[model samples]
Target chain A: MPKSNLDLINDCDSFPYDTFPSQQSAFTGYYTFLLPNDARPHGLLTSATVQSMPWTSDFRIDHSTKTVHLLPASHNPADLASSCTSALSNLITKAIQTNTFPILHGKHSEPYPILGAPKGPISIERFARSLFGLTARGAHLTVYTRTVHGLSIWVPRRSPTLFTYPHCLDTTVAGGVTTGEDPFTCIVREAAEEASLPEELVRTHARSCGVLSYMGLRDEARGGGGGEQGLVTPDLIYVFDLEVGEEVRLEPGDDEVEAFYLWDVETVRRGLAEGGFKTNSAVVMVDFLMRHGVVRPETEGDYVEIAMRMHRRLPFPVSARQVL
Target chain B: MPKSNLDLINDCDSFPYDTFPSQQSAFTGYYTFLLPNDARPHGLLTSATVQSMPWTSDFRIDHSTKTVHLLPASHNPADLASSCTSALSNLITKAIQTNTFPILHGKHSEPYPILGAPKGPISIERFARSLFGLTARGAHLTVYTRTVHGLSIWVPRRSPTLFTYPHCLDTTVAGGVTTGEDPFTCIVREAAEEASLPEELVRTHARSCGVLSYMGLRDEARGGGGGEQGLVTPDLIYVFDLEVGEEVRLEPGDDEVEAFYLWDVETVRRGLAEGGFKTNSAVVMVDFLMRHGVVRPETEGDYVEIAMRMHRRLPFPVSARQVL
Candidate 1:
């Protein structure tokens, strides 16, 4: 870290540059870590200075408050440099091996407590998640409503018996993607378990659109993984978006779903409007259907552009662009 | 596989109604198999033929000996007049798995095949390949030359290679995608590995004008899994035609090349006039580039135009209408 700028810039001798695609300027310089002056692993620069760094400065490490801040610039880099710091060496290794640098999305980003200060490899899999799965690791079957008449969603009331959230109108099907199983095949099995839909439904309704990656940060200062929990989980979740025709009835595979409803579109609208929805995920589902132009008719056989209308109604926090 | 026509076409129970996106009859069914009776896996099938009675028919049980197979049309209502046969069971299972369907451009296939039977997933991986880090698994990279002065290739002792059968050079910078990576990133890596060209040079000198998929089957039986060897390897390769700066020097990556040479239209014309060259795959590449103006020279540079014209001088064997 003490080397002159020019010396550091051309110091490609330590690492075999030919082995990787990176050039001198394209590659970040060598990195190292130093312990806190107090020698307390948890006692990082937790002084109060970070509480109020220059607003115009990129960011500051508010040691007194243990707050890592950020200063959003008008012009972002073509490929933003991520602060990669992990309490776990494996996560750090994984980050470098995979050619991805992670940065915490929220405030108090530890690895990057000081703005513009170089950080190390960041793992993307460090956040709180409810329900998630990997292909072959899990499967799902979505029952789409097709009728113009009326419909209801069948759900099982949690018994307050299970360790996790119980008694909920759960998705018809989901399971681990045991190694070696194709995702499409897994979905069919899940659909049958959830809705008693035929395996054929899976074959016909097979929709392997694409995948999306989500990354976040975890801080040990907040009493998270600093010692044993230092750093966070690194993972890749494979998502499958699929649907089955409305004609399919929800068949009981187990006590998973005690019942389902065949609700009409108006009932859904009413539920959304009244803020009476049980789970936010249901809203996500409704939004997906609406975006794809699936909705109820104004009257039997009457029509309204559901997808367009729903899109217009939603307040988008992100820009209207595909996931980069 | 024994049942009357009445039991076959009219029997609702034997039909796999569940496979239908709609209970309509217009849609087709496809299937896939992980392995043959011997337990080796291959590829997925793109087509199928079924018997009409009791939906009873036996599909091809072995290589070079395929037969019609009938399967239940739907599982929603399993009320067939007779018990299902092994053939029927296999067919129905295949249909439900969606392995019976083939992906477009999934592999290089001839425009036509005589067996008239669909390909199978008879699962297997590459048997023999290059031993270096650049080969093996689903990952690897290769670099070829591209048109610079004016779009023409010069071949030197081209033989045994899949394209440029007679060794007339053309289409540089072509390469393969490596494991755990997508094609977009692989090609750029290939260029660097082969020519030591910086990414900026490659990006600025090249353009991803378009893409195409093909299966290069020939006038012989194709070996699959443990079956007899075929003349082709099925790969979903993406073709990228590049245009480089005229002054750039050529650097061959490995011993795979005998030597490198840059040729203009007259040079190429002289080579072909003296001998002629055109590998089946090379023919396809050239046809693709020419038909799309992907390697047009007049617009590229005088040398490039001359080189492109030299390609035209080759006895392409097929007419523009035929190849185009």
Candidate 2:
């Protein structure tokens, strides 16, 4: 049987607060990763990862409390950034050399900021974020056209050769919000690089329609592959809507996307019910349907729960002011 | 100093889960109100209110556990409804006669369903919701028009003679969702009754734009009047947006609204910062601003926090399926 719409949202927001205690008992348990001078835990670490830390004057692991504290060498923003980055780099290198985690092998030079660090924003390789259970921010845009029949959306299938969620359906354009990059710029850049959309058209037409947040659990059923499973993943996605004219054409700008499909509302709904779209992308699509009056309380019995679950309150501090 | 946009949201979602424990220590702790078959608490009752309950075989107030369980007369849905409603009606009458709670004096014949009731939906008077800390559902609609300068919204000033939040600003059209009405129907009816809007126009043009749920505390600072202060008020508002042509005019259909003003975005922003809107109305307005891209991460420091707080998870179940 196909999954319900509520199931799609639950797939993305699997780890609610009620399940935390139960999950702790079932798994090896996670350690709270706290930065210096911060009262809140900014990340989570598995027991094995906490034990493998070098403790090179930059970290303090407290077994009793199940916490790993980042000990910065200096209070200065510049000094803290460099010190923290170098320590994390060393840890990732050790993990790669020892074949401890295969996910780190996909790490690139791109640094994603750990939002709301005490002294300043700290940087970590994008691929390593899930290992620490850090919050990930990204921008996703849904491009559609209003045809005579109804609204049709431009959907993309991710490249089968890609490392994560290969061959899965995705939003028209989406990319991680890299360190020092705002969501607007990130979406515009992604639109051009991933969908061959003109910068001017995207800049002029993209409507910022708010955000969707969820505490996801990475697992094989939800398209988690080539990496560790059962990792706590907190994600905040800035959502955008773009209604393009019929003259506009969307082509695969790079190899990241395999192809594009212009699916109508019924087609999209059918695909969603069959779990054809990526987890987060399915959430975005549901949100679009709600905003466009497609999915409603009159039709969907789980309307209220679905809407509330899509905007789950993340555990970490997300104030952009904390970014350096 | 004028409040920022974040303050507008914080004013509505004031009672987050973090403050629940502290609030219990400061004030007389609240008792969890549970139905006989429910595993979760569906409402909250103040200690004083719990003590004053008639307890005529319809309730089981466990002082040690700080719980008030509703003991239904029978397992039948009709029997349960009458038993619960009569018991609550008696309670409200006693409170009104003894002047135990001023809020009950404003109670009417309208019955609001207790969503997610185990046996079936049992209802209580709408005005008595706060006394029992039950969730109140409503429908709010924002009407706007396109102009040469920018977008202009139809803002309504609530009637000065009203019982609650008199003379304050509200959405273009808003009203409580009665027991048997769905949100879409409720909004259309409210649009006609509140704003004198034609039913044809609203039914044709009103777009269901999702929902906004928040855990609000009823206090004087937040425009709560004619009632007891410091009551737990959980709200779920179904939001709709209608774009009218420039030729359309909005008139106050009834005494509920004193007047209507078509204010531009800047004017609305100034009014919001000046704290001129009601608490929930302010939240709805902020959502409108966000959906329209008037507020962005580039300008607002508390952008992410503001968005997340607006959708606080209500402690009670809100499934429409639970409503008969």
Candidate 3:
């Protein structure tokens, strides 16, 4: 039996935060990572990771409160950034040397921002984000063209050599939002680098269709990076829709994407139902179906629940301005 | 000073459920309305309303737990609907006759579904919905046309004589979703009845853009409806987008709207910033701007927060089936 559209959403947003008790229990035993002078938690640390990791003076783990507090070397924005970055860098190096976590082996030099952090210029290496359950922001673009029959989407298969979710179906152009880069700019850059899409074509046609936030749990079934299971993953994906002309073509520019396939609506639905697409990409496709009127209340029983779950109110702070 | 885009959103989603203590206090002292066999609350009632209303065998108000459990006349669907309808309708009639809640005076004969109720074809008169703090479902359509200066929306002004939100700007076509009516069908019907839009045009051009769910508080500042203030209003608006040609003209099919104006993007923004649009309509319009890329993260610092708040999770059940 194939999975329903709601099931696909649950595959990505698997954390149980529906009930008041469940929400309380979801983070009860986890070690909270907080900035100095802030009551709101920025990240969650598992007991196993907290026990195995080496401690530096920059971080003070209060066992009583189960909190890991970031004690900055200085309050200045640049100094805070430098101190935190060096401390995390040294920890990642030690983990790699001891072969503790294979996920750190695929670390890139790119810095991913802690989105809602109060202090300025706080970021860590891209791959090590999951170690402390911080919210990861990314941009995903769903490119489609109207055909005589219906709409067809440009889908890509991930390169098998990639470390995470390799050889799975993906959005036309998708990438992480690096530090200081907005979502739109990130998508444009990823489109050019990964899909060989023309800059002018993307800029002119792509529509910002809002965002999807979910609390994801990285378990072993997700495959790729060999890390401990049940790492709390909160994600905020900025979704974009690009309606291209039938004449336009997409080619893989790098080894990240294996190939591009232009699949019709039915094919896309079948792929989603069969669990062939990557979890988060499947969620994006489900959102596309809902937005385009392909999936509706009349046909789908879980329409309202699916829409609400896709945009779950993430527990962490999302904006530096503290509007919430 | 003009309000920023995020301020416009906060006008509708003003309830502070961001913190644990705030969420706990939001419904702490309120009376819970539950079905006989269910533990989850279907509605919330204020103590004042409970004291003034007449009670029958159908409902048992437990002062100990601040709960009003509906003891259905029978468990059958038809019987349950009849019992609830009669119980609420009689209460509404007495309230209107004695001049208790002026909101009941504006009631229509149409029935509104109790969207996640466990038993029966449960529905009640539309006006009585706020008294019990039930989730209200509606359909809103945003009609726009592309021109030389970008997108121009067809905005409507409510009739000054209307019962609620008089003389305020509204979406192109908006109305409540009556019982047994799906959102798409409701929108098509509303478009024809409210905006004089052709049935064929609406059926063909209108695209289901998705939904916006918010927890709204009905207060005195909202105006026109003479109801008790601070009514818990959880709304699920099925939003649609209709792109029409420039030649199309909209006239008032009924007295709900006085006239229609084709406001350019700047005018719409100014109207929103100046607090001209009706509260919920302004929210729907802001959603339109976000979907259309008029509001970008590059310009709005509260980008992520606005998107998340627009889709706050309702506490009660929403769908008939137990998908959640």
Q: What digit string (tens of lDDT, one per residue) describes model 2 on residues B1-324?
A: 998988888788877454201122322477878776666677777776676655556678888888888885544655776677677777666666676666666445588888777665678888788878898899999999999998999999999999777888889999899777888899899999989999999998899988888887777665555446667888899999999988999999999999999999999988898888977899999999988888887778888877777877777888734321
Cα distance off (Å), candidate 3, residue A103: 2.8
Instruction: State candidate 1's TM-score.
Output: 0.25
Q: Is the docking of candidate 3 incorrect, acceptable, medium or high quality?
A: medium
* CAPRI rating of model 2: medium
Ranking by lDDT: 3, 2, 1
lDDT of 1 by residue, B1-324 (tens): 432211211121111211101123211232222211222112223232222112223333232322222233442223321222233334334443543222211222211111101221111112211000001111122123445454454233433453224344434444544323444466677667655557776655443322222222222232122221212222333344454555666666644444556666555444433433332224323333333334232222221112211122111111111110
Candidate 2 lDDT tens digits, A86-110: 7777777666667666667744557
Candidate achieving higher DockQ, 1 or 2: 2
Error of 1 at A243 (Å): 45
TM-scores of chain B alone in all candidate structures, in the order given: 0.40, 0.91, 0.93
Best-fitting candidate, scored by lDDT:
3
Clashes of each: 90, 0, 0
Give candidates' CA RMSD values in order. 30.2, 3.0, 2.2
Q: Top DockQ: which candidate number?
A: 3
lDDT measured at residue A149 in model 1 versus the true structure, 0 to 100: 63
Across residues A190-223, which tens digit of lDDT does each residue of candidate 3 receive?
A: 9999999988878888899888999988788866
